[model samples]
Target: MKSLMPYLKARTVEELWEYHTKLMQSYGFDRLIYAYTCFQSAQSLTNPEDALILTNYPSEYIEAYIGHGLFRDAPMMKWASRNVGAISWRYMWDDPDNTPLGATRRELMALNKRFGITCGYTISFPMAIKRSAAGIGLVARAGMTQNDVDALWEDKGEELEIINQVAHLAITQLPATGQSRILTPRQSEVLELVADGKSVRDIALLLGRKVATVDKHLRGARESLGVETTAQAVRKASVLNQIFIVDPGTQLS
Candidate 1:
């Protein structure tokens, strides 16, 4: 098993997801999806754009699942939402007396089976922030069963759980530049100025731009962050590390 130190030092979300995928595959669980959100609620992870989601599932499966908003009802996701720690996929069907699988979950299971995602585990990370949650779903490789997964877990679950939790922690420390709305240098700069309590006119003077141009930048940032206001944009950008970054010297427009 690899040391958790490597994951602790991960520099980017993509790098961390890639390494974690490879590590999980070495343990017989091949395909995986990871999600983290600070905007979770009783209903759903409000604003999917605000979440950090990474996956190695087939592109078609991802398109169908996320594009249609089906992940909210995924069996493992439902399990992860209300619980923490590692659980086997069999928990959904094997012991129905405790928590019966609904019609939606049964259909979701069928869809997963179509993609060779039959048996696996989901590890929901313990979160410290209010309304925040993070978890990963690891699908066993083709031809493997939940019994096989349980066998592996009985021996190596502790190490796997530690590795996943560490990776999730590393993800929180990095920018979730995983969506189409990556902030340009200009957008990031405008948000940074806004966070510093600079008015549009003040930013215009500081950046040698017109007031209207500064407003345009602010509008662009709001659009990029999928927020309705400059304040929201600044808060979201700060959470995602899109502003006040560690390497401001390298952010060339």
Candidate 2:
């Protein structure tokens, strides 16, 4: 795998994608069939498999997986959804029941016929923000012996670690979308005045409430925005479009 140590510092998704592609290429397996699914409802599959990945795969392959519901049934997807680390199919054939060696494993044979994929390795990492898991699938043609798969995993474990790190970086880099946290009417009014630079005492007097009551509203606003400080609460409110901004100081009423 090409050195992704430098890309650990990359601030954008495109840079990370390029670094990952190069890493996969070094291993002679570059097609990354990555997908993200909610942990609570893997069956629901709100995000398309192709949507989460920065690198693109064959359109036919994408269509095939969705059309045939392959992601739902693939054992690797099941492994990835539950675990936080790397997994490969080198020993899957050793399973006594429904091993990949049998005719009942016709799904594997069908995949080989349709996609030119005979063997594959998998790595899955859980997403930090959402209760979901993200996985990267590396498939290759036959002749990759178990030793070869082990060697590749040993050689590329560091790269996979970096892949996980870069994924975390991308998640943090996402801009805060303009969505508002729901709040009570009084809470909204209290924060709105604070945004206009009004002090708590002044707000309390204007709203005909006790100072303690006004303070409670501000605290609730902070909790709602998931911030420690009032300024951060204000900024989050504005970012989520919960509160509209006024250049010249305006009242909530």
- Give all TM-scores, in the order shown: 0.86, 0.54
Residue-level lDDT tens digits of model 1 in 5-122: 7676666777778888888999998899988877777776555687778899989988778887777667677777778898988875553236676776676777887998888899
Q: Which stretches of candidate 1 lie over 4 Å from their true place?
A: 93-103, 177-181, 248-253
lDDT of 2 by residue, 3-117 (tens): 5465555534456566666666666665666665332364544335222443356777666665666555456666766677776676443443354444434664486457655
Candidate 1 clashing pairs?
none
Give me the displacement of residue 110 in model 2, in angstroms. 0.9
Q: Pick the candidate with the highest lDDT.
A: 1
- Relative to the true structure, candidate 1 reaches a TM of 0.86
TM-score, predicted candidate 2 vs. hidden true structure: 0.54
lDDT of each: 0.80, 0.61
For TM-score, the strongest prediction is 1
